[model samples]
Target chain A: AQTVTQSQPEMSVQEAETVTLSCTYDTSESDYYLFWYKQPPSRQMILVIRQEAYKQQNATENRFSVNFQKAAKSFSLKISDSQLGDAAMYFCAYRSAFRGGSEKLVFGKGTKLTVNP
Target chain B: EAGVAQSPRYKIIEKRQSVAFWCNPISGHATLYWYQQILGQGPKLLIQFQNNGVVDDSQLPKDRFSAERLKGVDSTLKIQPAKLEDSAVYLCASSLRAPSNTGELFFGEGSRLTVL
Candidate 1:
């Protein structure tokens, strides 16, 4: 079974600054996908960014990026130019890249991020 | 494009009562999922359907929980004799697993359930 872990339960960042949320996972599969999802107080879960384990280059989407270290089993999310809208609970998820069968996402507990203006 | 839609944004029921949640996935999406999000925890998948066929339901509490996707477009999750611990948010999501797509999932505003 694959499990994702988010060590930081809470994080704080100042507006216009940057913050990194740490996540790690345990999986036996060689190739998989990592994702970061954001859930605002409205309880809407939205995908932030995704990284393929086979890709050496990190994934970047606007102000959101991921530092995926396959060897270390670490996938961290970086939020740049933090804004008040970034205040939400962030979840790290893992999914298998294999075609067919089950492909449900395994998510970590979550990291509640607070942006102070 | 319209995102996934869920009904009964909020539901409150007493323990041992029954509750149900409805979900309408995005059009043309081949896969649909039902997730349970307990307070302070990330959403955990309860059941998955691939175009009206059950794909995975290992984590679902079969004795108390039931779900169905009759026509592969809409789904429903029902909990009978709900337990207080079942109080949480039910999230519905859909994904397209086409050759050109990356299997990205689009989620809906979850239906919050409170079992008193």
Candidate 2:
């Protein structure tokens, strides 16, 4: 079974600064996908960014980017120019890329991020 | 376009009571999912359905939990004789799975449950 781990239970970042949330996973499949999801106080889970294991270049989406080290089984999310709206619980998730495999997502515990103004 | 819709934003029941949640997925989405999110924990998939057909429900606790998608659109999740540990947020999500689209699932606001 594949498992995801987010070591930091809580993190804090000042407005306009940057913060990185660490994640690691254990999986035997060579092809897989990693994602970062944000859950606000409203309990809505939103997608932040995603990375494909086969891609060497990190994925960047506006102020959200991911550092995916396929070799080290590490995938981290970096939030730049953090705003107060960024305060939420961030979760790291994984899914297999193989065709015909289950498409359900497996998620880590989560990291509570606080953006202080 | 309207996103996923869930009913009863909050529910409270004593242990051994029964509760149900309703979900309406995004229009044209073929996949729907139900997830359980415990406090301080990540969302865990409980059941998945492609249209009206069950795809994967291995993680769902069949003993007390049940879910169904009707006519491949709306869905309902029910818990009979609920337990204290079953108190959590129930999230409903949908996906089109377009090849060119990002691997993102549209989520609802979630229904918070409290079991005493």
Candidate 3:
């Protein structure tokens, strides 16, 4: 079984600043995928960024990036030049590459991010 | 491309009542998923379908929950005699195919269920 953990319950960042959300996971599978998802008050889950376990280089998308440390089983999300729109609940997710037919994402408890103006 | 669509943005039902949620996956997507998002928690996988076929439903409460994806395009998730613990936002997502093939997922605005 794969379990994702987001230790921070809440975080706050000033507008135009940077913030990092921490996440860790436990998985015996060598091949897997890590993802960061954002959910606003609208309740829509949106993809932020993703990292492949095999890739040594981190994944970056616009202002969102991931620090994936495969050996430490850590995958953290960094948001630069944060804006008010970045205020949301961020969730760390895990999925197995070896999933036979049905592949589903396993998510961790979310970190509530507040952007201060 | 049109994103995944879900219906009944909000639903309030009494415990022991029945409720159903619908989802329309993105065109050409062969995989669909249903998830439950509790307050302040991440979404949890409830069931998955691959082209109208059941894929993984290990976490689904078979005794009270059931889902179907007929024709592999639209899907429905139902809960009979709903419990208070079942009160959560139900999210629907779709992907191209296998996880290794399609790394991204498109999600719909979840249907929020409140069992009183």
Interface RMSD of each: 1.2, 1.4, 1.5
Candidate 1 vs candidate 2, TM-score winner: 1
Candidate 2 lDDT tens digits, A1-117 = 999999999999999999999999999999988999999997688999989888999999999998989989999999999999999999999988877677788999999999999
Q: Please identify model 1 stretches exceeding 4 Å from their true place.
A: B98-100
DockQ of each: 0.77, 0.74, 0.76
Each model's TM-score for chain A is 0.97, 0.98, 0.96
DockQ-sorted candidate list, best first: 1, 3, 2
Output the better candidate (1/2) by DockQ: 1
- Report clash pairs, candidate 3: none
Model 1 chain B lowest lDDT segment of ten: B96-105
For model 1, the local distance difference test gives 0.93
- The TM-score obtained for chain B by all candidates, in the order given, is 0.97, 0.96, 0.96
* Predicted candidate 1 versus true structure: per-residue lDDT over A2-89, tens digit per residue: 9999999999999999999999999999988899999999778999998888899999999998888889999999999999999999
**Tens-digit lDDT string for candidate 2 (B39-100):** 98999999999889999999999999999998999999999989999999999999875453
**Candidate 1 CAPRI assessment class:** medium
Q: Candidate 3: where are CA atoms >4 Å away?
A: A99-102
Q: Which docking category, incorrect, acceptable, medium or high, applies to candidate 3?
A: medium
Write model 1 residue lDDT over B1-116, tens digit each, in one string. 89899999999999999999999999999899999999999899999999999999999999999999998899999999899999999999999864545857899999999999
